[model samples]
Target: MLQKIIFIFLLVILVSCGQETQPKPYGELRLEYPKPHYKLFNSNSPFTFEYSDYAEITPAKKKDWYNLSYKKMKANVFITYFPIHNDFNLHLKEAEKMVYEHTIKASAIDTQSFSYPNHNVFGNFYQLQGQTASNIQFFVTDSTKHFVTANLYFNSRPKPDSLAPAIAYIKKDLEHMISTFKWK
Candidate 1:
């Protein structure tokens, strides 16, 4: 009787161990953007990143000027460009106003800034807290070269506790791009 009980326990453990415990893979996201232009700035900042091998970077087309201009992504990453200016602070103020006006349901606020004087680069990172989810806006400028503002929004509420990993990964790449930013 004891031998039979031991045999049954071992059998159950073996069967459970043999069962698959891994999650099924998910399908890739879909996105579309205009042409991409691969122009390099003066800085030596690296743009290395890890994502699915399926993503393609195309040139930013002339037709898509001022609208959302970006390289194709498996995810929806809309990048729009405004003209670069010598007075970057004014541009940042304008961006804040735009966010406040567009995101009517949210209370948008500037969180912090990171500056690199050696590269003449300055950036302000903002957080928009809505009734539901939150959004992020990054306003960057190379005082003598280029001015840029990037806003990232998603349907889900922006919970820092849950969104930290993805945000950190994307921010690293974004910072690389901003650090190397320049004007034609």
Candidate 2:
């Protein structure tokens, strides 16, 4: 009986050893994003634009400022509106300054100019490539009165690789917003 038991135990051990111990085969995480659905943000405010239906807009402390929050994605778009009031140049400078402020941590900054001449909406969109607090910032203006600036920030740490999907997702919304932007 003892011989039989030992033989069985040794057989189990030998069989187990035949299987090579190996680390898991590396695989990239698959992150999926929902297809975008937009809603018109036509409010009593100074401007109107199209925004993602996923986001909920809440008024910031400032009268014309809003924090558009994406609860599931843990991100927010901080939007501030200033009526140019003959200070368009000042607002333009400040918008450029905000983008440059991220230069310390950005690997590269790409600026793309877009205009919807039919809507009278002209804008600059900046994509900050790196682990920065805000990955995207933009401002659209009629170049006469309405000046609106927005920043997109994730609630979590700025891990560019991990956040790339979300960034790309929100960018579509940004594009839609800019194209549909209109000053009231």
Candidate 3:
């Protein structure tokens, strides 16, 4: 009788467990961004660049400082201008220092040099990969009287895999801005 009861219990357990165990498949997100449209950023700040229509340029608290806010993307491109006044190397160091601050969280840092001799716009673009506070930081200077540095910051926490699409989208805009940058 006991053996019969045990057999019945085993059968019930086996029948109840009918589903096979399998690992869940990874998910991929399909995100699309609109084609970029640029507007000339001719300001009284002694510099001009063609910024994306998608962004709204707002002046920062300080003079000659501006924020290119991307409301839809929850990001901002901060532009800081400093008249060299014999401190060109100081400004350059500060910009580079800002980029290195994220080294602890960055998987890698890629540097790209850009030059538009016609416009006297020369700069270094830094792209930070991995979970970092800022993904991109760059500085453009004519190597004399005018120096400008910019940093791209997202409102959300850094998640490289999830943010890759948005990063790529904004990166193109930055490239366009750099290309059209002029010191006036």
Instruction: Please report the candidate that would top lDDT against the real structure.
Output: 3
lDDT by residue (tens digit), candidate 2, 1-184: 9999999999999888876788999899987877888999877798888899888998998888999898888999999999888899999999999999999999999999998898888989999999899999999998997899999999999999999988998999888888888877
For residues 22-64, write the lDDT of model 3, one tens digit per residue.
Answer: 8999888788888999999987999999988889999998999
Which residue pairs of candidate 2 clash? Answer: none
Q: After TM-score superposition, what is the CA distance of residue 72 in candidate 3 from its true location, in Å?
A: 1.3
Position 172, candidate 1: lDDT: 50
**Quick one: best TM-score, which candidate?**
2
Question: Can you tell me which runs of candidate 3 are displaced by over 4 Å?
Answer: 1-26
Candidate 1: TM-score? 0.47
lDDT of each: 0.51, 0.91, 0.93
Which is the winner by TM-score between candidate 1 and candidate 2?
2
- What are the runs in model 2 whose C-alpha is more than 4 Å off? 26-28
Worst 10 residues of 2 by lDDT: 13-22
- In candidate 3, clashing pairs total 0
Model 1 per-residue lDDT tens digits across residues 1-184: 9999999999999878865688989774433232223344322222112222222333344322222222222122334445555666677678777567647666546477788676666777666654424356676665554566666544455455445444444445455555554433
Q: Rank the candidate models, highest lDDT first.
A: 3, 2, 1
Candidate order by TM-score, decreasing, is 2, 3, 1
